[model samples]
Target chain A: MCIAPVDEMRKNHMTMLLHQRDKTVQQGIRGQPASLTGCIDCHVTPDASGTVARSDDEGFFCTSCHRAASVKIDCFECHADRPAEMISQLDWKSLNPINHSSLLAINQQSFPYALQFRLETRSMALNQ
Target chain B: MNKIDQYRRKFLGAASAAFVGITIAPGILLQAGNAATAGQGVSDAQRWGLLIDTNRCEPGCDACVQACNKENGLRSIHGPKTDAQWIRKVSLKNRKNGHVLNMPVMCQHCAKAPCVDVCPTGASFKRADGIVLVDKHTCIGCRYCMMACPYKARSFVHEKLTDQLPHAPRGKGTVESCTLCVHKIDRGDNTTACVQACPHGAMMFGDLNDPDSAISKQIKSLGSQQLRKKLDLDTGVRYQGIPV
Candidate 1:
């Protein structure tokens, strides 16, 4: 569950997301808790067929809420509605072999310190 | 006052000062840490650019184009007109001298970008480091940027894309062009996929503002040409060895 209350999130999530987008896309400030990718990673629910996506399914988290509110969700139109695992596997090292550290640094900034530490430990355990 | 009273007042003053310092210490440290990290943000002092030596570009070579497609996950849908091509090889021949030159053309990343000016939603914008990109979330698929662009470099996605790099998020209906590998640039990578793929050493990527940068030095010594210099767009990309 997110840090915010469900009721508050349901009412003001869009405002939070918009603020996050401005900070991230415009000002290049990332790794905040309100990132869209983080939201999808946490809240996405799988349908009966075990497919989790934003559209073409009524059970998806964003779709269900937007459908209920009758508000158009245009983010899915251009962005992946699911988590990174559901998308194509990206070989980050191959993409920029020379600057993988910088890539990792940017990714590190995307999450809070506690989550980031947990993720690092999990990855380290997996690697071992 | 007695010596004990004066000492007590001095102790209280010092203790209050220590308390105030302790109260603000974390915030001060955080600001310092942020200043160190915030240096990663694109700065106006650096104008990232690319220089193509057309004379060195092999005519049959499509390595750069192929690499770009692979890097960006641009798949051809059998629609020659609609397929997104971030970069393409163009062969130019001098009419009188019959001299032929081949060069790759992509987004110019202009200082005075027409696409940015014409964009109704302001999704088309140039970064502080001079790489122009489409904020896909707000693009609205208007295609106004396509019309405004003089280079015909931008393309509209005709279909949905399932296989997309997390770094390069593209989708149907949004107008996209050569980002100059913005993901790489933002991560402080000095090279682009096309620049790395060019086997003939035809492409050079570096900071244009830095006098010592390879592209800047090359432009100064060899004399590079912008595609449409008349527009005074101050494009970040330049080409050398093209017949005037």
Candidate 2:
């Protein structure tokens, strides 16, 4: 089940997200009913062809509703629309070896920094 | 700015926001008084801090810098003039004996942060837990806080940023600095990227307010001093082994 009913989320998701943002940012409270990253993890997924839809794509989760309403989502401008694990699963060929640290943490699943050396070495090797 | 760069930013953002579900630190709940919330609230009861052991810091190693860039999704834009360097390695040399000291330097996260004092929009503020941050929501990109910072810690985003890490949402027209990985801290991660990535264990982090915490104990036992101590900023980060 969704955090809220799909209709309820559609109507008031922005307010909920903002509330969560403030609570998390200012209060350091992590538990909440809604968050941008949590929403992306659930709503957005790559196709079997290994391609995730961009915000511009009509089939994209947020864009599907917003495009018809003609409201643009400014969230994805700074926040990633996809979860981090999915980004790592993306093929290395499509990823910019220099511009991004994607394709990191394939072996280490602990903390984000657990695999920094591996990522640094991987990106350096790719650059060469 | 271009198509590939936009795509790359999104990918990098995901990469950083990913790997956040690791196990919580062992002593997080062990800390007393604040035990009721399971580390959910930010209060002055806990002052987050880092102690860098300069003796262990490798002179040429940039692991901490690289890890910070990867963790925060910071990439060079034009060059040194416009790059957002949240953490950097600096070497200090003495002409008398040629004594050299190299250490990682970023936002000192002072109790009396100059950036927080100068922000016109109240965007630069300190958390109750002593993590100084730039509130991107209210920031007007005035660059006043950047000018006031004593450690030269703050940076302004000149080019439009895309696909910023969901946890660390930065954008153009805003000044940003080392958040001390506030996103990770808020989520109950005990250490920051630079501390965790240090190959020589040069960096240690914990609640500075807790007497029993490793950071406080080490600062008491091993001894450390802040940068610009005379400024009376009461910095959260402290350094060890700076030559006299």
* TM-score for each of the candidates: 0.70, 0.78
What is the overall TM-score of model 1 with all chains considered together?
0.70
The lDDT leader among the candidates is 2
Worst 10 residues of 1 chain A by lDDT: A119-128
> Which ten-residue region of model 1 chain B has the weakest summed lDDT?
B28-37
Candidate 2 chain B: worst-modelled 10 consecutive residues by lDDT: B27-36
lDDT by residue (tens digit), candidate 1, B1-244: 9999999999999999999999796344333322112533445667888999988999767788778887786766644545677876665444445566677778999999999999999899886667888888788899999888877778899887664655667888889999888767655567999999999999999989999987889889989888766668988999888533
What lDDT tens digits, residue by residue, belong to model 2 across residues A8-106?
988999899987776566556665668778888888888999788876678899998887898976776567777778654544333222222221221
Q: Under CAPRI classification, how is model 2 graded?
A: incorrect
User: CA lDDT of A25 in candidate 2?
Assistant: 64
What does DockQ come to for candidate 2?
0.12
Proportion of native contacts found in each model?
0.10, 0.22
DockQ of all models, two decimals each? 0.06, 0.12
